[model samples]
Target: MQREDNFTFLTEEPIPKVIGTMAVPTIISMLISNLYNIVDTYFVGQIDTQATAAVGIVFSLMFFIQAFSFFFGNGSGNYISRQLGARNRESAEQMASTALGYTLIFSIVLVVLGLLFLDEISVILGSTPTILPYTRQYLGFSLLGTPFLMCTLCMNNQMRFQGYARYSMYGIIVGALLNCMLDPLFIFGLDMGIRGAAIATVIGQIVGFAVMFRMSLHKDIIHYTPRNFSHRWLFVKEIIAGGTPSISRQGLASIATIALNVSASQFGDAAIAAMSIVNRIVMFIFSVIIGLGQGYQPMCGFSYGARHYERVKAGFWFCVKVGTAFLLFWSVVLFAFSDRAIGLFRNDVDVISIGIPALRYQLLSFPFWSFMIMANMMMQTCRKTLQANILAASRQGLFFIPLILVLPHCFGLLGVEICQACSDFVSLLVTIPIVFSAFREMHV
Candidate 1:
């Protein structure tokens, strides 16, 4: 009876109300998570520019870890939602367990490899001589939390796709709030410096994992148990089909960060620190759109499975319109205060100068992301795998990768500042036709 209610809620609730109900908690969770990063950046910036830059350098590894977590989380979550929509509860349960099991095994391997190759990985992440020691300290401790972090994300996505986003939000909010509290205690009070920041983050991830794991045991939610774990070719294929877009999207983001750091390193530590701060700020602002798109995903998945195509289309347009308006407002406000915003993280003049224009330039293309992100999420959820993969790789991979390499060489510092904006514009152009084509097919 409870399960039937969930189906009715997803499939019959007015599109606006359904998305709003789902998006509010998701937006809050995303904001809290990004806020913790901002807070972490602020505390680290107090130490010195080098320490702040070290965190930037280590962001590549963090992105890599998140990429895999999303790979498992989105992959299984996508399948789970569709299964639930089709009233195949048994299959959804199996997928939940399998995703958790595989995520654990994969994250353990990453921990081992990351610990063994810490120095090499740090260097590969574009750590400069001045920043290498801080990078090593932070990355080493951060690696210890990889499994907990990865599994927490996996479970969070699973619960969200199950239409229990409030439970997912609770786990994330609790962890982020705890991390914010611990940051000052561990970093300044303990005098642990950057290492303290890393330790606090690890502890937060552990607590988040515990909370979400307990929540998963609730009778309403699907249970993940060892008894249901399976790696049969069929399940593997389904996970791959549903999850590859996320892997491409996040994996390329990791690679793009590495490229950006390497390119920025050519200038100096100040450049790296500046760009890093800009990335965090942008991510914080963009979290709203991501939350909206995530809210749309489960509805899209369930409706698509249940053959309610009109609801899926309505939800997509609703998200795009709302997201675009939100970004437009922020772009103008942030553009006016870019310098002040940049200065809040780091007081250095060079860092502020580089970050100000970068933030503004990116803002120019920010509104377009509403359409791009919503379209990609729609494609991914609807099992348009080929289109999803292409869009996923476009901004960061196909366009950004080459642009970062060439633009920096041609335009010097200015090129580095505007590369992401350029990539975003081109990606938007590429996405237009693909999205329209998908819409046409749905109508037919």
Candidate 2:
């Protein structure tokens, strides 16, 4: 809670400078983390389109995993940053410790259950007969690392929330580099194929978790430890309240992903493969937006708690402008290069045929998405949990799920292709009024 170090910088430094400094590291980390998936996809894509489709099927489950990580991680980290801003160091420490402890315990349960129900889970994830074996193989090994992945994710969020984005970057960069290096080796060098990709993924995640854990103990301003952990109902409620938006966001995204896969499956494996590739490419660019929003989150949390109302307003508007520019730049490029980009993954006429329109359609809505993401991140960090959850679930849950379900039935293949774009555009409409209203309240 001391204002002598990072806390001072977070609370008192020039808004642009502090946010820029925080954002760069976080942006790098997001790239590396997303790169993990890209590396896996690139390597696995070399195996076969079926391999790529298998990964697509498993992708929904990963969303399910991340939902929990963010639920607790964002929950605890958001609360911790606010507490630190208010100079309540003890509560922050307690929440940090308890969050990690709870995450570890629940992650073990997830891994065990995941392994036990591995086959059924694969089927539930929308794996086909041809893709089922690979899906099971990849998920079996990958699921074992759930604990580490959750820990790494939780720690990374905590580090960023506390303004230690550099430390977070280190852990992620190390793991991502390791994943990239090991991917070809294990998949091709050792001839393990999809299983190799999964093995490499687990090792990379564990190392990343280890690096973050060591840094959490030594390098970070706020640390998680056993002595500080307490299983209090109040803290649990707070974490769920603060993190509900993320859980809703990610959880609904998972459901939407599964729906997308199932809907696309009605067409063929090419549809699944095409949609997956577009998603990864788009998310790669979206990582920058997420990183920017993360950079803005701490400022929102710190400023809101410290009662620097105007700083919160300035930071929100600042990030929205920056996010829009970044997104718009990527949007134009991706829309223009949609064909070539989809071809990068699987050079098939069928895949490219399905992918091109989907990619361009999704990119069409990218500009408007920046506002919604920035607003959602700020609301959550500022502890406007109800509004945050509504906005969070709006894109994927309220808009996306129904759109994907109905659109395919209405327009068949084209419907599936345009579902996400439709969702994003609709979300923008819903978000603008809510966010601007929140902004209006800040002035009062």
Best by lDDT: 1
In the range 245-319, model 2's lDDT, one tens digit per residue, is 998888999999998998999999999999999889988998899899999888789888888888998898888
What is candidate 2's local distance difference test score?
0.89
Clash pairs for candidate 2:
none
Quote each prediction's TM-score: 0.99, 0.98
Per-residue C-alpha lDDT of model 1 across residues 393-416, encoded as one tens digit per residue: 998999999999999999999999
Question: What lDDT would each prediction earn against the true structure?
Answer: 0.91, 0.89
- Assess the local accuracy of residue 349 in candidate 2 as a C-alpha lDDT between 0 and 100: 95
Error of 1 at 107 (Å): 0.3
| Model 1 vs. true fold: TM | 0.99
Model 2, runs deviating above 4 Å: 1-3
User: Where is model 2 poorest over a 10-residue stretch in terms of lDDT?
Assistant: 1-10
